[model samples]
Target: MTQRTIKVGMLMAKESPDLISLVGYQTSASAVLIGLDRINAENLLPNINFTFTWYFDECQPYKTAGYLTKLILIDKVDVVFGPTCPEWKARKISGGIVL
Candidate 1:
């Protein structure tokens, strides 16, 4: 069987200095990584392999836009998951234009 690698871009929040917040961030990031590991271990996609890069956006609109552009244009990621914040959602559209 032929093998292929899919590049995935993940946008996670930057870790906070507070202990509680840091733990939360770590937990969230770890969940995604664990899920990926499970998929890879099970060979769920047959001959397909998945690779990911993490980008910390701090859930800021400008940072999210910049990182997303880099992920698409420079990183050439096949898919992206993240920036789970209402601010990013708002930035997704502006003045009737999608950004």
Candidate 2:
């Protein structure tokens, strides 16, 4: 089978620091990091490398929108996935991709 190689970027809401401090967040981050390591070791993606960055905002709608813009534009993410607020998710899915 042909392997798929793709670059992945992750972004969480400014509120992510709060969630990441939780037990669940630590567990989840551990799992994802391990999983990605395994995938990389298996040579499933020869040309792929994942890079991560954190962005924070005041947690206001417009401020969040501004952060998202900087994330996409300045960070140059090929694709973004995350632990975002419901409202942030809605706007990002609807219009964030285009920007």
- Candidate 1, residues 1-99: lDDT per residue as tens digits? 888999997776656444326434577678877987888788777888778877777766777777777777788888877654546443464213323
- Each model's lDDT comes to 0.68, 0.56
Clashing pairs in model 2, backbone N/Cα/C closer than 3 A: none
Each candidate: RMSD to true structure? 3.9, 4.7
> TM-scores of the models, in the given order?
0.71, 0.59
Instruction: Give the runs in model 1 whose Cα sits over 4 Å from its true position.
Output: 17-25, 88-99
Model 2 misplacement above 4 A: 1-7, 13-18, 21-28, 57-60, 88-99
Candidate 2 residues 5-83, lDDT tens each? 4444444433445655442344545766998899878977676666665554323466556656666777766665543
What's the residue-level lDDT of 93 in candidate 2? 50
